[model samples]
Target: MALRSVKFMTRPFQHNSNRSIEIFLGTMNEGNYLNVGLGGSTQTIHPDDAKRLRDELIKLYPLALAPAAAPASKFKAGDKVTYKAIVGYGARGMDGRKGVIKDVLANEWYMVNFTGGPFDNLIKVHSDYLAAQPVEPRGFKVGDKVRRTTGQSKGVVMTVVETHPTQARGDIRVDGMTGWRMQKYFELVTDDPVEAVKAAIPTVNSGRYLVVALEGANYVPGSKPKVHVTDIGANAEAERLAKEVGGTFHVFKATFEASREKPVIPPVKTTKL
Candidate 1:
């Protein structure tokens, strides 16, 4: 006996101004079948002659396929924006204040000059922190992976959720936590935790790196892990101290000019996690 296999295909048809239909066509055991779906209803039919009907359906609902437009930024430099204070986050002490965009920085960051705020000049902030109207932090959305910037949950990674319908009133929801949270309290993290962990741990032979053993295990995941540059050298002392205190150490390559600091060395590839 020969083995039986199924072949599947799909096509979309416009039904009305606001509705569309999708048809899933398939063949099994020398027979033709169609699974038609629209909105929430789905119907299947096994017809003796499906090809002719399929072609007729395509002609009945003229294909409306077109290219989608690209998304554009809502704000630009010199644009006026306003947002409520996020308490512990940036723009603190400036509740319901208006500001002007001094400059647009890279990676969705902006420098804003708020009226009668904490700083006298422009301050750098994320795009989610500012808006056209007086609103809570709109930086986070559903399914975003983020880390808290304050309180006990600081540094702990979590995902954003829309548990409640009133999410626009500064009630950002996240997994494993209750109550309404604000978007200003959390920042997006790298999608891959392992890569983030590895990038944070500096390589031993990266040259002129600062080493400091942290007070907790798995330095990246700890709450407010603090470590000063104890020494500025790439050596085995970091590994030794990490094992001795049952904690972890990180390396940082610093660049200095006179009393001012410059850009540090970038993270290098390493076999060690």
Candidate 2:
């Protein structure tokens, strides 16, 4: 049997956009090959880099074409967990609240339902804010009427169920509900855990960047520019795009100073105006 080989003859191509194209190894001077040029004209690749470019493309093309695997989540739906929020009604309003995992949001935060009457809003908190359910403290016993002193269930009166006031802390069941709470979070209803009211606070994101084509480039009317929100993401994207796509990168500055420059000291104009 005779040996055979497959090959693709790349045609010479010129880059049309104002952006700079990164040339790789195994690039060809002509024939359907990737090339860079200006104003829609064809240009040649760096002769020395042609072979490496071809070999790398052969290895990387399969990865690009492979089916992508679904992203994984640490916690799944229906899992009982605790998440922290900026809002709550208690002396320490930023306390952890018990929640049920509703949905796993891609590879990001978890969508949690802070299951209760007062916590109406859905919480999408990151994994860093989550913790295991806390155990009750000592000295809690059954038949005792208690009210939560901290966290989301604050002021909600709950009655102790079966007391285990021994090596393990006791548990209390919420009044009119079946869920049990740790005794450490509460005091006798007669003591009355009065909490200060606080408003909910929202979180904001930073690291946003915007990139647009240069003034003279051809563009569809009203086209939206690119936006990058990751740290150092927008700047890198903007710079790379500016090189190849011939565009201007605008970094979003979060703050600005508006003070006049200080004057250099002069020996005082003591001679009056």
Which tens-of-lDDT digit does each residue in 179-243 have in candidate 1?
Answer: 77877778777758897887467544333455655555543523543334444343455676677
C-alpha TM-scores of all predictions: 0.25, 0.24
Over 4 Å off, model 2: 1-71, 85-94, 117-119, 134-273
| Candidate 2: Cα lDDT at 155 | 69
Clashing pairs in 1: none
Put down candidate 2 lDDT per residue, 156-260, tens digits, no spaces: 777777654443455555555556666677876544334222211222347545554446665332267566675367667668877887756455543455788
Scanning candidate 1 in windows of ten residues, the lowest lDDT window is 1-10
Candidate 1: regions farther than 4 A off = 1-78, 81-137, 150-156, 163-169, 190-273
Position 193, candidate 1: lDDT: 87
Q: Report the number of backbone clashes for model 1.
A: 0
For every candidate structure, what is the RMSD over all alpha carbons to the true structure, in angstroms? 21.1, 32.7
Each candidate's number of clashing pairs is 0, 21
What is each predicted model's overall lDDT from 0 to 1? Answer: 0.65, 0.59
TM-score of 2: 0.24
Looking at model 2, residue 238 earns an lDDT score of 63
